[model samples]
Target: MAKNTTKNTEGQAPKGVRKPPATRKTAAQKKAEAEAKLKQQQLETGEGDNTPTDTPEQPNNEPTGETAEKEVTAGASESSAGQEGKTTETDKIKSDANPPVGNSTIEDLSDDEFDKGKRDGVSDDVEDQELMEGQMKLEDDGSTKIGDNPMLTDTKDKEEVQPFVRKTKIEKTSSNVSIKSLFKEWKKDQALRAKYRQEAEEAIKSGLPAPEFEDETTLRFDLAIQRNETWTDYQKSDLIHTVLYGYYLQPVLVEDSNDGKKWFIDGKQRLTTLMTFIEGQWALSKKTKPVYGYKIAGFKFNDLPSEMQDEIMDETITLVRIKNMTVAERDEMFVKQNSGTPLSKIELIRAMHSELSEQIDIELSSLKFFKEDLELTKKAKDKFIDVELILQIAMLIEEGKDRIKGLGADNYKEYVLRLKETEQIFSDEMIEKISNISNYLTLAFEDYEMDEVKKALKKVNVPIIFWTAITAMDDNLQPKLFGDFIRSFLISGYSVESAYGKSSQAGSSKKENVLIRLDEMSAALSQFIDMIRNASSIEEGVEQFNKHLADVNGVDREEGEDGERESA
Candidate 1:
């Protein structure tokens, strides 16, 4: 090996020397060399004409060649040893300045360069200083001179940079807040009324009509079509308590008539209670809590403080409106509205509007016999019991009790329906006949003074009395005689177990029972009328009937004693 000293001519290493491994440059040396090469190229081509040609160089500004490489390697080794697991500031800056290939840091790269880097798996850093300078120039002159990178240029010059506008949150005002909160604030601010008054005055001074606020509580009733009063005082008091306590109230239903009137379709009771209470017609119940530090129990609307009064007036009532409906449709709607609390059969019949129903309501119900003689309470009248009785009487008179099948509830409903379909007009003669019969009945009951008979006459026995009177008496029939005949017939039925008593006791509404009762009563009445015809006075006739009743009682007592002895 020592003898082989001949060198290879092509600059190859000598045989067996294994050419000492080539020196590898550190990252810093390579970066320095690349910068030197770029400077030399720029100088040779005169590309950087602004370079200071006469600038003096400083001593030891930088190392050169092998010495620079040696220094760079040694410095890198020292840095590597010192910062084994940490990155220095200078190293970080250098790393950021020279990002790895395919990194997303070079935003201003040309499309061609980007594509080439993508294909070659290499990326180069874009000089941020150059890009920033180009951007500043472009902004200054509104020109596109951002090097060769079209990505940095603004293509849409006409597009505006929209200024961000933040939405403002709405603040709750007194008018838009909850009613409870509004009332609370109103109570605290006692000057609210003065404020409103001042506003009204200003409005008037400005030649504008003073603000006329409509009261929501003011509602009208169509007396002919609306239902009668059915709510009791206790019910009204409960509603008043609900109002005082601020409980939710259901909305009132109304119909806007063609005549520009608002009529109540439903909620009559509720609306009326509210209106009456506000008008001081009734006092609040004991259940009402102290409102605004004042005990409102047993207090009228006038007794309340002005603030509480205003709160009641300011109470909001929702209204649902219907328009242009017929009576039948209204009736159907009323039934539907009151489905929860059902109406009575007679009430429902009355709701079915017809000329006859109207006559019963206006004429018949208003008659003295029905108004005074029936002895109906306000509640009974409100339930339409009077109307039902009067309607039944009228039907019997018109149909001639013999022609009617029965006077049960179902039969009565059918008759009402028939009346509606026919729109039957009752004649003056029929009406007069009914009135006379009613008058006779009233007078007869008043003069007879038989408590048991009179009591029976008020209820189911009324129709039988009417039938008997019509059958037995004529136009010239004396009231005294007629009264005497009725008294005798009732006494005979009461003193003995006769057909009248049996028929009147049970199944009274049955057709056969009604006929039997009528026949028995009419026969007795006929015989009494004939017996009284010869009598000199009503007293004499009554005396004779009493004697007859005594004889019948004597017979019954004898029979009862014999049966008692047999049992013993």
Candidate 2:
């Protein structure tokens, strides 16, 4: 069962070309050289038949349609081995890999049309039609419909079509006249409801749906109104008025199974609004609206007549039941649906198909410093800014400035997108490095019992300087410098300029600004270290540091000399 390890180079060269006597390489080296030659040939000819064994295996993260296309272009720049006339290693790998059918091949695409195909080696199991399933179909009147086309047919005892494409669009029908009888409340059995909740929570944690829950309701806004903490009074009022005016609510997407269980995919806002009104959680706004059946605009559900209440209940909301889509695909639909709506970066990250952001967030949250010690406003959890800062720092350490050239809060939306596309960001080694940074920070900060140090560290720009400084120092010596470095750095004029100057405030997130700030802080710390090394006493060191600060900040000490910069 032993495989052949020898290279068969007998007739590889073209006719009339005299072969040079081969070097006395070992079998492994010979095999490797042969592969290199084969790869070169494939790249030159755009022939992907030759298999290159040296290429590293791509990670298992599957990109959606749009991102897959991005991979093709990104893949080109990713390959360092490309030559003047040769196709990129990404092209070679993609040619050999099982690309999703119907996707444009590497050879057909120009450099501009490249998909970072290198990262998309894992073939998507979800079929092409399944991907196109929930795509919004526009009607003549301008309403968006989900599941407008019947992707699958239920005709029994008939020949199944090879490639089914629904030719007929699902037509819109008038709303039911009898309000109370047309629609029923989305009620699930007790066991199914519990199961749905568990799955919904898991989806909220990570976009990947639970095994059994994808087919059933993931989130029921009617039953789960208490859980949505972000729904505002103004938003609820708008929804109530919207319903009272008899405007058609957007179709709520659901995954309906043969067993008749329904799982919600989108339209939670509209659904929650309707239910909140019916339950009398909030009355209609003072804005005049009695158009449906009500006499007064500000009537609660109970204050309305029985027929009016029945009319609201019987009002039909459109339902788009999905089938044949993967859990990732399902999550993608929700993300796309909420694309225009205002949402936190972390919330959007959770709805994404990748697990990297959520995984990193979970990891950061587990740290005691992140939970209790670090000063976080209540908005931190909702806005997820804490995790966002952690991720930015993690990337700063991981990618270095060459890759993250434009890193800052200004381009954070773009930065995170690229981070998701990048496979190396979430490696076990990288995650451990982040953990080490966190541990270093916790130990270095917590060791000092001074409340002043803790309060100073809570400021926004301080951690960036502290973290950058600690990371720049010798690992063993980082803890030693923490207290002195923090106090000294805070007492510098540059810290105040860096933290509060108009230039710093306006350009705080600019790439050049971030680099300059870090560089100057490092320069200041380097001086402090030099003072520590040569000065005879702590008093002498402080005096030297105070004098050195003016020079570091490029301010003239000849005109004025101060004792020390004020601590934050």
Candidate 3:
């Protein structure tokens, strides 16, 4: 039952090709994936003879849909049996003894796209449609209707009919309406409502059974009235006015309203849905005061609960109006909205670079960055890790200049991200590429007598120190590169080596290269302010690091790398 352990030359992984950590799914997950694949195959073979009968022991189809239904039943039993025949763990181990390395497959080295609105990797069960479902409002009778927001556009079965395409986050497309699209959509909805209302009134007056009208309603409004915390009566009244306009202008929108071009800065779908329900008088249901009468989307002036309902209703239809601004304005607008949440200096700096006026924001973010480092170390959370900062500092020390060449900023962000994703994917040899960065940093800071490096290390708040150390190893980098860098970082203030392994400090986990990397990090950051100023992107800044590295390589080459650079 055992196969010989030999590497397949053809299956060899492409050089520098790192594999994603292959996660083994649970039985339920595997079953779902298998079923999905089978369904897809069935679709492809519906009218053809391509039904897979490669295994005589498996179900054979009759080429009829009825036959297919029966075959599907039979296939379940046969497939389960086939699954049982898969290689055992021991056998798998023997066969995989010489598996392929990510040693031919090419991957596009695209920048990581940040999805800011939601947390990363929300469960698949949490569909975008869920947001729409909550987009409900009471019909005059207190029933629920689905929210009509463009974000929920794909939720309807009809929208799914077309073959789908997955687009990258940064991909440029005409219809990827920026937050600016809110006003335009609102105006469109308003016009549509007015036209329908006029036709209905005419039909009613003409003694017709029913007037032509759109069956559903959507959430769309261009006003910044919805915030999670509290909604004022004035804001509520403003919202009512917007909805009232929709009802009055039923068949003819006053196109002259100057506020009709705004988009969502916040509460995007929620605001729009509230107004839509009110305008269309759709059925909306909730826990209490569940029905906001579809007769008109008015809030009861005397009732507190009614006021709350109005707030919810307003939220479902509110949007922030946008102006025709350059890309810089948009970036600033984004940053301002995110300001409520604590952000790293690197993140702020990256945004600031797009605007000459906002360049000073980097200092504020830097202070935030320092605080984040402290917090990350205390909590050992990944978010607190200052990966970009460490890389910026490290590359500067090693390259002598402010930037890395080729891929740009010394591949700082890329390196950090890869380490995070494939912490276990790359081999020890491969890991050295990053580990050396840590060592070089340590040696670079050793020459400086500052307490700041020690403080940063002692605080042990950020994950950056650990990664910097990990990357400073050979993966051929020595301790010298970052030791001076670390020292310099602190000379502007902190010392780290004073309590090398002292038990009294906040972070006492002193692995051999840990302190060394911390020092390197300190040194890199201290001396690399200029590198930061020159950085256009995370990669570009690392190029400045190449200049720092040139000096480091020269020193290490001449003095010969000390035994201090050896792996623990």
Candidate 4:
């Protein structure tokens, strides 16, 4: 007999804070629940939640807040996936045993006490202005104050530091790049998103497909490495490892197609990681096995991200090499900004490199050629590039708005264009920004202090890689692109899938197979790395990633579930 579900109506909805208000926890999805919760909490409020181990949705979204909640959240008892009963100390997750997740905040965050004291995180000043521009009420001096609007309090009470601006007006260019185009071109996920996956359960009940062999592309990411202002050694290693093994190593369609419906071309990193993971490298010391089982049936350290490994097992690895896509695809994937945070990291780096080449000839300051490369880079590249790295630099240099390091209402981008002229801010060029950055990275790795809040450098092994990949690009005034990253990554997962159930498909080849999303975990990680390391705009990067995530799972978020504060 089925038991009845009851609801109390006096004033409360339920004893617990259930997002979707459903109860179906599996060995893996259950864990995803906790991960999902942590990711969301971190995003909704720019800090790790440190709720008691028993409550998944309550506090300290900090990466190292409490393993008790992550490991013991109602359904974690099924497997011992390194999910110990309790432990959320300042130390990394488990370096030698599992390459720790996050550490406490005690090390340098690259800013002195005076600087840190003056900032909480970046203010949404620009975002608020964009939202309330014509509608804003001003004082006699034409300045907006916190007392004017209550909503502005979120940006002000936080004590965020407003960044200095020095950019001229943004030259407007015309294009058909709609919001949808921003997130275009990835592997074609023709499958019936969550519905098809959910049907696996029914398929099994009908005695058709097996549990372990369902669509392996279903992915789930670790919340351990998600952070912004601060990071620890474990967090850094996890970031690099997650990228190397998960997304870069997974099997994906890399090539582009004529029709918008199809996805082609997979990333190179996806191929390399699979070789080491699934193939088992038996001849080498690692001695990898060539067998496949439940998500991560036979791989080593399978617990961490076995779900994605399973997806790789299901698909055939094919290389899609195209020097330059045909006219249209090239326009879409290579240079398109279909998504908010599209290819900012890569395109921006290339843009930065391109801009530095000319070095803004002081003698030619009167010539338009001086900043032509920088300007054109923005127009030519997709919005995706802008969202990631470029956006981060904006947050860091400006008001720390991108990273949430300063306070105020969001006027960042406008401020940059109006006052922070690009040349004047960075000596017309910011030199020596990278050399010693490597030294700090090495120090972080060798017995370093940590941030429990931001989980700074917790998983890094190659800090220089992050420094160059993320920084070393065009300078935009903003703050904490890192915080944006944390919030967006989680929002992507939440918006994509909230309730887990059987696929609605009637007769899928994957019928009877337990729908799992392990494969996409790597993709998520890859996109995250590619975004953080290469995107041109933080807003663009988040949008693109979220869209790609939706494509992978067939679950889209409402328009405002998560977005750049341009509209506030």
- Winning model by TM-score: 1
Highest-lDDT candidate: 1
Candidate 2 overall lDDT versus native: 0.54
User: Which lDDT values do the candidates have, in the order given?
Assistant: 0.60, 0.54, 0.39, 0.34
Instruction: Report the poorest 10 consecutive residues by lDDT, candidate 2.
Output: 114-123
The predicted structure with the larger TM-score, 1 or 2, is: 1
Clashing pairs in 1: none
RMSD of each: 24.4, 32.4, 37.0, 43.2
Compose the digit string of candidate 2's lDDT tens values, residues 142-244.
5644442454645435786799787533332223223232223333333577778887788878977655544354344322111134666567666656665
Ranking of all candidate structures by their lDDT, best first: 1, 2, 3, 4
- Give per-model TM-scores: 0.54, 0.48, 0.22, 0.19
Residue lDDT tens for model 4, 196-285: 666777888899984553333312111111111122333333333444343432323333233323232223233333333333431212
Candidate 1 lDDT tens digits, 450-522: 4534454556777777766676457466665676665545543244255666677667778888788777767
Q: Quote model 2's TM-score.
A: 0.48
Worst 10 residues of 1 by lDDT: 559-568
- Candidate 2 Cα errors over 4 Å, as ranges: 1-232, 255-264, 271-319, 339-353, 365-374, 378-380, 409-425, 443-463, 466-484, 487-503, 529-568
Per-residue error at 484 for model 3, in Å?
24
